[model samples]
Target: MSQPKKTFNDLKKDIIDNQICTSCGTCEAVCPVNAIELKNTIPNLIGNCIECGICYANCPSASFDADDMDQKVFGRTRKPIEKLTGIYQKAYQAKTTQEDIHSKAQDGGVVTALLTQFLNEGGDAVIVADLEEDKIWVPKPKVAKTREEVIKAAGTKYTPSPALVGVKQAVKIEKLEKIAVVGTTCQMRGLSLATDGPLKNKKIADAVALKIGLFCMETFNYDDYMQYLKDNDVDPGQVTKFEIKNGRFYAWNGEERLHRAKLANVKPLIRSTCSHCTDFTSEYSDISVGNVGSPAGHSTVIVRNEKGQKILDAAIKSGLIEAILIEDFDKEETLVHKLAEMKKSSHQ
Candidate 1:
């Protein structure tokens, strides 16, 4: 029997309605016509559908084979060295050498330092999550071409920003030649699909030069996050920083702690799609960074491929960043694997 034909409506039912849409905006970005738009952080069809199936094909929530896509992009798949962490050449506990970056960065300033070095050395553009003008806490994704702009975009926003949307804007609107994309797991998965899927778009494929993925357990719903803060009598404007660590969500105003909630208390605000995602380490990205296994002021770095290694080496050699071998890579890998399993079992 022939397989059933796919369409945009199928994507709406299987993904959007199922509450598993990552909202990476690939549908809106790759649509032949202006048919898809993000409404309240969900992709909605606003125009006619040609039943071309691009939306369904590109949606990360629908799933794709990681090894197949890896082969297409890099000429081979990552070596199966570990089950949860995928393939990687090295692991390190690293931080920026620059004191100013360490002071302003979210964690260890590694990502901010790396991006600055990459751009200073002729990298074209980078997509990052930055604050939306007039909306202090909300993140709006943008392509930053300068070191200053990249630095300004530092720090993490617990809410999803769909950085691939910025990738779309960069390649099409800005006519950028090469781009580095920094995003969460799902967002990088969308990029992997775009670059190597059967219906790959060459423009999107050629435009991306590097992919940096973040370690994420889940992202929050913007409305729910704001409501949670308001219900607790906390003001968003005064929140100098937000972080998840040691089973708690912390909101700080400079040196003052404004609010502290158990991670369990905040689980209700998590985006539903995150529960179905198993990639806690961004398996498809060139490099992945997070604070899970490192000290309070350090970051865990996974160098996944040669390209990632090259950039990392240059950064270390130039004194842009410093590195130390993780005390026990296996112990940290175990921790990451446990979380990956938790997310995977949620759907079962």
Candidate 2:
């Protein structure tokens, strides 16, 4: 009575068969020897794979076996609290005005608020994406000490950003004690996959003490977003405020302004992979934060785990956030509205 040995190929087969792979490209990025390539929405494992198990370990969809084991061993199985629940409304201190954080943020200042709290409390680092010289998005996992740096990194990236690229670097280089990560739903799920199984990379998972997930409707490809700017006579260089407001997009570049355009008007340029996605909130995250149904300048906070609640409580105590209770948040209806928007935009 011995357990069967698992091989890399076996793992690969399971991943392909499951059809759960979002193709975030973490496996390709983590391979020490440059063995994996993303081809046709799937990973083409090429080159010399030493079967380091990085690919198998990083595949988010490879958790079927683990889920099964959890059910068998624990007598019952459960997903992370974040995933099981859709959304929750909680109040936070509004010490910083929406204008202060909003002006610096992409849309709402929720991302900046969460990151600032972690950094002020002596958290090691914050992982985020920044605009690059070549117009390509790059991951920057900074060891931030000041609120200024944290604010600088806060904003929404509407592109298919490689947010997970910094996970490995955070583990090996900074030797961080605690790190707060912000990402969309797919990226959070990818991180979740990296934490489980025999091939778990402890450095990446253990260092991530706080997971702040942003609500994602759909992430457009970089080209599509750029084209959206162009079609609307927007100059990428002159762009100031880019926001999704009231089911429409508003762009302000210094004195010039654009308004009342549905996201569907920019449909030709969206990423194809986004259409197949179903998760709007990063279910695996400890807390999911967004501005979906809240007042124009306020953030909607959903605390899903004990860690999330504790972090939020500490932030409030430190006078970093203001709290307010949402009377009724129609989670399902909101999701339906978002989905319909995505579909309408895609068709356009």
Candidate 3:
């Protein structure tokens, strides 16, 4: 006998009410009908439901099987021993060649370079985190179809932006083809689930061309973090850049440090749902990029499959980016593994 199908109601009970939803917005994104909306970062059913199961089906936290999604996305399962950061063809320290982009990027500008290349190659759009015009450093999902737009969206905002919602809106609503999605680890998992889950959303699956994941230990609550900074006598306008390095978060104003907080000291401001996530290195992504193990001003890039490798190679050949073998690839992998284990043990 087969198990009963799950609907948004099940999603609400199993995920939202349980307080574990990552708020990646996959549910609202995949809903065939505009029946779902987010209320205070939690999804709620607002319209009539025909019992469609796409919401529950594509949810990252609804159920997750790393091996299953891996085979579906890459056509092969990872070896049991290659469990730390998933299967990767190579790793490198890379940076964008465009100085303006590099200067604005959170770390190395690799994501901006890759997205620019894809768009130039006729990809319709790429989903990215954009800062709201009124909210400094607040991330909102935006779909970029040009190099300038992608560059404008470069850099990291430490809050989750529900990026897959932007992907769905761009692909399903705007009728875009060949879209690339750049997201945090959980958001990447949500994209994989939409493509490969039992629901088999043909529109979403066909539209997505590339999936890039960013390294994330945890994301903070937007309001909570802003208030925390205010309480600590930090002015948002003084922050020229926000970064996490060596177990501390820093807000820099040109050559000056505006504010600094140890990672542990700011733990209380972390999003509650992040405590349920264990994917520190985006194991389900085609390629993962981060600054964790790489030196300052360079991104650690993990090439996971032929597609990812092909794109990286093309970008390098076109002079959009430069790369070199990671100086301490082993050490990089070790750091990634340590964080992954820490998140898993603490979350699970």
Candidate 4:
């Protein structure tokens, strides 16, 4: 059974004392009703919260607040593992016709399809990254609803963003009940921390109904990406699609012309923090989704929790997705291959 939902005041206390409030003003930006304010790097609830739980749900620092457990395995829990195993046991791969969505998406249309399923299932909202000022280079994380909004936020961020910056506020304002988060492996690690440890808060963890983690090779800094575009004589503004596939950097603009470059040519351009990261797949998340081992335009999904499995199963039943059996992914081998490929491509 689910824990009893907390009131707005209960959530506010958790934020003031427990969570890391990063004064990003994300809660202020996404709140449908002006109920929160940022003061001295902390959110101040100004108006009466509607008990929607949006603020609590979106808080990145909010803890899991269950039984005490090892800090190292915060978000990496048994629940997700059981779910993942179940999915893998029944796993199958198939091609999807949702080409338009797939074309604009970061990997396959799997992320979009999952997000759509959540929205259709009475989910309050989805937390994702968006252009801070309508510029591709400037990403500002935000929670959204409409298909257009999610699409606009689509594509790989390739940067270490404060994507979980708003989670605390969502819980405080009570504006969200069930939220689905799309984040990378590092972000999922942080979420795991929040879900475990003494700082764990029940209100926030319960609010985060789902987490969708993306497979990350590494994230690039915004400045580096812009510089790479300039050096390649490619205008970042004209580029409509950018992807790293088979250890190659693929970019395209308005015309059908495609520019394929080796991944090695771009390694020096990545963020310093990404190199130290070892978890390419977010083991802590409810579901890990990416295109690591799948064919071009196909997503490899690892359902990590019963909640995640239930959602995916429902989507399949609804005909929103198709499943097929494929070779089980050996995580260690896959990582080694990815690293080797990146190394080889970088040398090219």
Q: Largest TM-score belongs to which candidate?
A: 3
Give all TM-scores, in the order shown. 0.94, 0.77, 0.95, 0.70
Q: Residue 179: error of model 2 in Å?
A: 0.7
lDDT of 2 at 233: 73
Q: Residues 1-348, candidate 1, lDDT per residue (tens digit)?
A: 976657789988899899989878877777777688886578888999988888778888885777776676557666544556767778888999988788777888888888887887788889999898898688988899887788888888999897878888998778898889888989988988887787766798898888899998899999899999999999999987899998899998877999998999999999888877878888788888988877887888988889888888999999999999765665534566677666667643
Candidate 3 lDDT score at position 57: 79
- Model 4 residue-pair collision total: 27
Give the alpha carbon lDDT tens digit for every residue of 132-204 in model 2.
5554343334445567777776666566555566565565565776887788877776766665444556667
Q: Provide the lDDT at 49 for model 1.
A: 90
Give lDDT per model, in order.
0.83, 0.62, 0.85, 0.61
Ranked by lDDT, the better of candidates 1 and 3 is: 3
- For model 4, how does the per-residue alpha-carbon lDDT over 1-348 read when each residue is reduced to its tens digit? 997655446656765554434333444443446687665435678887887665555443443322233224433434442322222222334333466666677666777777777888988778787766766655656677777777778777565555555565455454577788777765665565454433444555677888877767777767778888888888767766778887798777744545779989988877654544445555566777777667776787776557778877877777777766455443424542454345335531
C-alpha RMSD values across all candidates? 2.0, 5.3, 1.7, 8.5
| lDDT digits (tens) for residues 289-343 of candidate 3 | 9997778989989888887998899999999999997655545346766776778
Candidate 1's TM-score reads: 0.94
lDDT of model 4, residue 162 = 55
